[model samples]
Target: MKIDAGNVNAVPSKRLFLSIIADYDLNRSICELIDNGLDVWTRAGRRQPIVIDVHLDPDEQSICVEDDAGGLPREDLGVIVGPGQSGSVATAHETIGIFGVGTKRAVVALAKQIVITTRYQHAETFQIGFDESWLNDEDWVLKVHQVDDLPVGTTRVELYQLRLLLDDDNIKMLRHHLSATYANFLTNPAVMIRLNTVPLEPRFFDNWAYPPEGSPQRWSGPMRTPSGKLLRVDVIAGLSKESSPATGDYGVYFYCNNRLVAPAMKSFEVGFTRGQAGLPHPKVSLTKVIVSLNGDADEMPWNSSKSDVSTKHHVFTALHDWLVTVVKHYATLSRTWEGQWPEKVFVYDDGDITFNEVDDFLTAKRAVLPNLPVVRPRLPVRITKANSGVAQAKPYVVGLYEGVVAARTLVKQDLSQRNWLAFNLLDVSLTGALKEYLVNDAGAELSSLDLAQLINRDRTVSADLRARVPLPDPLWTKVEQMGRLRHDLTFGRAAPKISDEQLAAADAIVSEVLARLFDVKLAA
Candidate 1:
């Protein structure tokens, strides 16, 4: 064979790099190691009683983990603890330990030194000591010794110079986290995990059985991802009455592989109720939708922390779109159910509830109203120039004086109906030749109508009354501008005669319209 080398000193490419930089907490790292070890133990089909015992002494700053798995064989000890070597998942299957570096990296990352002792089923027992300096020292020897008698199948790892300890609270938290993280395994009688001396009790959500006789409306189905993988979705919809209460609780939850991924609806950045859709006095209890993506769905490109899904993944995009459609569909169903029931009669309770609570409740409730048209106050026809010369008919220029006056009247009416007469009123008086001429003529007709109805009628009224009405803009803008102005003030370039009282009244009318149509509180 002829050998030809173009670059003899070329370096081989590295396949993987350490993703985490900072030192991890010792207690947490130990837990992670145990979790990885358990995965390795279970996959080997050892079947022997497996146990993890942790001894923590804060004063000594040391922690130990002993597991009864088929302990490391004498020949495999070096490779098992070697850096960048993975024994788990050499075959195709969903083995929890994808990378073999978990235990080795975690111990080195958390503690100053680690000691390992193992007793194989039919091989001589051996012990090894590992330290940070050993990583770089090729000549450094590991303490390995053969023992005559040892536990049949046990591996013990002792971490010294620990950075932290597991207190009572932390132990409790660890128990909970372990139970949740290994829920499926915890249910298996073959696998047992204990924290300190206490055996962990796994509380799975699926264990909560439904009431037999009285069951909530529920829909359960399997959703297939673009890859043809199945994800389970289950929803428990509230009763029609429950769906639209004046104030109610409604929400959805996300799960992955039977694990609750996100527990609260607030985490989704969307409300549980229909208020998001602008319903007035909305009392819709949310239909609780619970979803569970399959375990294999981890390929969907979830973030490393698993807090959120990556939008770049097609599966995530499909899931997001599906959830949105579900929300909209349920909202429509809730509204339909609410409409079937009698209109809710509201009685203001001033005695029991605090004013703030009442205000907040009202504010939230008002966000659910259906959209309605707004009425603009009609301006009065004003004669700007009347009978300027003798023998001449009244040469009259129509002004918006009547419209301003009508707007004020409608505002006062709305205030009285809504019990908001205490609001501040700025006084404005109209002046200018047009106003004077209109006041002098005294033949203009101003009708008394709802402010909303009037606004709806005249929102399009331009400077030229005969011109077509412009499309109505957002109500909030109009209401805000009206509220900030001084009374009887002229707006726009044309100095039309307007009074402060009229402006205040117009503001009140706009506020009333918004409250009724959109459940928007314009006063504030």
Candidate 2:
């Protein structure tokens, strides 16, 4: 007997088909068919235009995806149905399709029966049917035949006996997914995609800009995969013009090989709130970062379905620190932009700064930010109750009464503490109200500390605040006296005691400043 090396019944059962189809949904299955046409364009040297049209007939419960991107020849009919057989790999084509199961999985996921028609060069239309019986049978064989005439360089796939219902809501969502997934291709002149008779337009990310003081918003660098493949990464980060928080349009978008793998990610996956202070508040939602990775498709960090990033990939791990730094930088800055947005942000680039749409902003000529080491700024020593024997909220003019109560409670042990506490409260209230008058009414950037220093000495910002805030000379004398007292108390030195009459005078100054700036009376 001739000893033949035993073949171990490697043919997969019909259940494998069920498993494959179950892994995909209606949107993902449709995308797989579109991706097939795109791979054909890449294999054909990408010299000619590729037009794909998707038609949905809800009455018939069928879908048709037709593409003019180099139809399949007769020889490919046999191999395409087989699992683990990829034409791109066999022919050494640079394409996103690495596995051969995409088409088979997509077609079976949509319907129980599929008909594929193709016309290549001079050959007549080659037609093949994968019917319901083929799925139920154990035979791994398929039949192909020549059919009626079709346009050359065309492939059409029609699915019938749909497994799921075709509805208007799902069709609308599919349109949005296709527009965003193939956004880069839609921008090219040689490619056009239409769904249900409507041509899809690219979704552009709108950003905010300020012309004067340049804030860092763009960066580009190179990273090498573990297999030594080079991945060129370009990052554009800024505040969005549309300020809807926790929406799908906000957060970091990750694109691989011009295909959006991940969209609007704001979680630990993109290094948000990982050992840093970040939350999904409206200000943090204003932050938008687009990370585009262009290189070999196999080396990208995307998962199998191209729906999300693989956090464990070496290329993504190499980029974690950079992503974290930029995200935290912009998230912190956006939190401080609530009231100052009008004074600091603009809609368009004004020749001095290049803040435009995300796509154009990346392609336009600009400076490439160097990969500088992130030098964490030294944090100022916090004055806690343990060190300064006092704890108070930072004065910003909105809430001054809380500081007064805290100051009074801190000195309640002394016999003459009531008079001292009254003076301190009057001083803090006057300082905060005067600064508010300068910043809000007078249109200046003044702080409580700046107001105190301005009364004592001459500094550029403080002097400007004084010039902008119009106060009478008598009020200026009271402000000067309060500023001196604040300086002495802050340094823990002894200051002359104040009587009830002086405290009353300081109270009048506080009330006057508040009424002028805010048009509100002091609390009785």
TM-score (all chains, Cα) for each model = 0.46, 0.67
**Residue range 37-156, candidate 2, lDDT tens digits:** 888888888999999999988889999999999888788876457886766642244467666777788888889989999887567789888877898898887788889977888999
Query: Model 2: clashing residue pairs?
Result: none
TM-score winner? 2
The lDDT leader among the candidates is 2
RMSD of model 1 against the true structure = 16.6
Candidate 2 segments whose C-alpha is farther than 4 A from its true place: 1-7, 90-94, 206-208, 211-216, 346-524
Which ten contiguous residues of candidate 2 have the minimum total lDDT? 378-387
